[model samples]
Target: MSEPFYITTAISYPNGKPHIGHAYESIATDAIARFQRMAGRDVFFQTGTDEHGLKMAQTARDRGITPVALAEEMSGHFQTMANELNISCDRFIRTSEPAHHAASQALWKAMEANGDLYLDRYEGWYSVRDEAFYDEKELVEGENGEKLSPQGTPVTWTAEESWFFKLSEYQDRLLALYNEQPDFIRPESRRNEVMRFVEGGLADLSISRTSFDWGVKVPDSDGHVMYVWVDALTNYLTGLGYPEDTEAFRKYWPADFHIIGKDIVRFHAVYWPAFLMSAGISLPKHVFGHGFLLNRGEKMSKSLGNVADPLELAERFGVDQLRYFLLSEVTFGNDGSYSAEAIVARCNADLANSFGNLAQRTLSFIAKNLEGRLPSRAAVQPVDTELLETVRNATAIELPRLMNDLAISQAIESWIKAVFACNQYIDAQAPWTLRKTDPERMEAVLGTLFIAIRDLAIAIQPVVPTAAGKLLDILGMGADQRDLAALTAKGWYEELGNSGFTLAAPTPIFPRLEVPAED
Candidate 1:
């Protein structure tokens, strides 16, 4: 059996439509999942909407609709966005699902049984937008002298009868977990920030809210819903059929990763592990807090009138083009900015002009000159050997190493270097010129380019699935053979030649993207 690899994205809050940030996380997580699967892992990728919250309730009320009705309507938009972006999530869980409610209640009961629950009167500043409670010291003063959450979201003073979890009791344990694992939170920066916050000490967290009832009801606790974070965090388990010892629960429990935005690091790194420890459940292997996506060096916001809808961007640039640009332009684990011009230039240069052009010209040369027949083997030369080696190193070795370390941009960079090498080899060898002088040697050169293009296409499929798949199909490669192992296998080219698979007049896989006109 392949090793099980489980990953998840922070479920989007469905009070609004999906944005560029949502698309970025989904694309990044999906790429990792696809890479792992192609690398021979049994991967389960989960992404969805966080539908139960005060914000959901308030937004529904403002719109004169019930919260459930609003959740259904908005959650559809997120699902549509994921589909449009080709997110390969195994499950799209909604908190309103019966199984999820059961899972949340079960987790709450387990925590309560461990003596972590207590009744208390809670009075503090709460940020509705963030769905987080903030300590007085963490608040910042607004220009109008009003207290704001650390994220600059509005906060209100609230007094309520709430059930509290003894989060302070796990402070020492959480620190010890951090010290022992050292990688529970990724990107040294996020780990350092979390360690500092824990060292500052923890307060008992309010686990149930009595003011609103748009969430999972606390087990045996009347008139109260579980804290949105608690219900939200439980979703990771619920997707795997938790609270029941089923096959998925047994195999994929203790998630491999929880890929979330940087702003929510505390909730995952601090509160989540503590809750699992209280429930006697295993903690996830890692929580990676990726940085935000900005709009051309500025933070995107509604008031700024610059929040880009991901679907709109996808429509403007092709889906694969958008995916390739984001994965290449942004250094993972750091803030990235995108613009129309940036997307167009990046995709056109990397996809259309470089790899796409190399594949198109090489294949077209073979189809037009060789009557769409596979090139026969000719005397192997040192130049051919060297070119193949360069491509193998990039596609088979360097790219995998960087991808495994979550260095997505660097991995693509390595692949592009190989693409550049192929372009350079074609130019220097001048296969078109050789066709007349030495047809046999020309056959050898085209054969070498064919092998290199196949390897490049297989390696990059995880990032640009549609375009790469189309190119591979044109190359007569089978779906079963598009993997890392296949990239290094011997004699596949000979087998393709024997099979007499003819290349067709190819359509361009990656068309150059145009910048949309200003309205």
Candidate 2:
């Protein structure tokens, strides 16, 4: 049986529509899921709306609608965003679902049974917008002298009867977990942040909220409800049918990775592991805190009027183009800035000029000069052997290690290097000019180029699925020959054609994005 690779994006808050930041996480997670599936792994990728929070109830009240109704409508927008971006999550869970509520309650009970839960009076600073708590030291004075969360969101002091989890008791254990598994939290910066925060000592977290009625109810108590994070984070387990579907729970629990925004690093890296440890459940193998997406170097915000709609961006550019730019343009652990010009520049330069053009030029050469058939190879020349050897080594060794390390931008960059190498080979050999002088050599040149293109497309399929598939289609790769598993099993240079594969009449896989005229 293939190994299971479970990954998830932090469920989006449905208080509003999806933005480029939300789209960014979904696209990256989708890429990993696609890559894992292509590698023949059992992948359960999940993403969806995080319903049942103070924000949802507030948004509902302001709109004069029921919370459930509001969640239904707004969650649709996120689902639409996922669809627009071609996200491939296996389950799009909502915390409002009965199964999720059951799972959250069961997990709470397990923690309670472990002696981690106790009834207590909760008094602290809380940010409804962030759905998070702030210590006295963590709050900052805003421009108008109002107290705010460190994230600049307003906070209200709340005192209520709540259920507390003995997170302070797990402080040492949490530190040990981080020490034992250094990659448990990713991007050295975020890991350091988590370590510092945990080293400062831990507080017993208020796991249930008594003042809100819109969250998951405590398993036995009628007055208190599970804290929003507890309810929301449990959605990951709920997607796998925890505590009920024992088989699935046993199979996919302890997600391989939870891809999330940097702002929430503390929750996932610190609080989540503590909760899991208390429940005697396995911890997630890794949590990656990716940086924020800014618009032309400014943080995107509605009040600032700088927020870019992801749907508009996808429609204006192409979906795969946007996906490529998101993963390729930005270093996965670092922040990225996007603008119309930046998006257009990357789409055209990387997609059209580099990857797309190389595929077109070599494939067109084969189509026009070789009668739409892959030419039979001659004896491998020294140059052909060197290039083929390099390309083979790239597919077999370099790409998989990069993917395993989750170095997405570097992996795509490496694949593009091979694409450039093939282009360089064509330019040096001048396959076009060779057609007249050395027709036999021309066949071998195009054959070598075809093999390189096949491997490049297969390697990059996870990032640029649609374009890669089109390239493969035009290369006359059959359905069975499409997957990369076979390519890996049989070395890259081994499948040199004999009778020749027929080509599809090519359309430009990527047309350059035209810059919109200025007003």
Candidate 3:
């Protein structure tokens, strides 16, 4: 059996329509999941909406609808965005699902049984937008002398009857976990920030609230619902049938990664681990808090009128193109800026001019001149051997190493370098010039490119699945042969040649994309 690798994106809060940020996270997570699957892991990837929260309640009230109704409607948009973006998640969990409620309550009961839960009157600063409580010390004064959360969001003083969790008691244990597993929180920067925050000292957390009823209700406690984050975080376990002894839970628990935005690192790194310790559940392996996406180097906001709808961006620029640009341009743990110009320039240079042009010219030449027949083993040359080795090193070795470390952009950089090498090889070989003067040598050159293109297409399949699949289809590669293992396998080329699977005239997979006109 393959080793199990489980990963999840922070379930999106569906209080509003999906934006570019949401799409970026989903795309990045999906790419990583695909890479793991291709590398022979049993990967279970989950993403969806966190539908229960005060924001949802307030939005529903303003719109004159029940919270459930609003959740259902808004959650559909996120699901649609995931589908349209070709996110290959195993489950799209919703917090409002009955199974999720049971799981949340089970967790609550477990923590309570551990003496971690207590009833209390809570008074503190809360950011309804963030759905989180903040220490008075953590709050900063705004320009107008108003109080703001650390994220610069406005905070309101909130006092209510609530249930509290003994977060303060687990501070030492949480710090010990961080010390034992240095990579429990990723990117070093986020890890350092989390450590500093925990080192400062932790207070008991407010885990249940009486101010709202649009959440999982506290078991045996009337009129109080579980705090939004409490239920929200539980969506991870709920999808795996937590509270039940299921095979999935047994196999895939202690998730390998919880891919989230940088802003929520504290919630996942601190509060979440403490909750799990209280409930006697093993913690996840890693929490990767990825950086935010900026719009043209500036923060996106409604007031700035730069909040791009992800679906529209997908429609304007093909899904794979958008995926490629984000993963290649963004340094994974660092913030990335995107604009129409940037997307078009990057995709066109890498996809259209480099890899796409290489595939189009080589395959088209063979299809037309060689009547779709693959070059036989007798046509092999020394140059062919050298180029193939270069391609193999990049696709099978270096790329995998970088991806395994979660250095996504670096992985892509390695793949593109291989593509550039192929381009240079093709240029130097001058196969078109040799077509007439040395026709047999021409066959060897085209055949070499055929093999190189196959490796390139397979290696990049995680990031640009559609385009890569299209090229692989035209190359007549088997589904079983499009994996990392397949790249290093010998005689596949000779096997293909002997099988008489003649290539047809190829269609261009990566067409040039034009920037959309600004409105």
TM-scores of the models, in the given order? 0.99, 0.96, 0.99
Model 2, position 183: C-alpha lDDT score: 90
lDDT of 2 by residue, 50-95 (tens): 9887888899999999999999999999998988888888999988
Candidate 3 pairs with clashing backbones:
none
Instruction: Tell me the TM-score of model 1.
Output: 0.99
Task: For candidate 3, give the lDDT of residue 431.
Answer: 88
Q: Which residue runs of candidate 1 sit more than 4 Å off their true CA positions?
A: none
- By summed lDDT, the worst window of 10 consecutive residues in model 2 runs over 491-500
How well is each residue in 1-519 modelled by candidate 1, as lDDT tens digits? 999999999999999999999999999999999999999999999998899989999999999999999999999999999899999999999998999999999999999899999998999989999999999999999999999999999999989999999999999999999999998899989999999999999999988898989999987889999889999999999999989998998998889999999999999999999999999999999999999999999999999999999999899899999999999999999999999999999999999999999999999999999998888767669999999999999999999999998999999999999999999999999988999999999988999999999999999998999999999999999988998899889889989988979999888898988888882
Ranking by lDDT: 1, 3, 2
| Cα lDDT listed for each candidate | 0.94, 0.86, 0.94
Candidate 3 TM-score, C-alpha based: 0.99
Segments in model 3 whose C-alpha atoms lie over 4 Å from true places: 377-379
TM-score (C-alpha) between model 2 and the true structure: 0.96
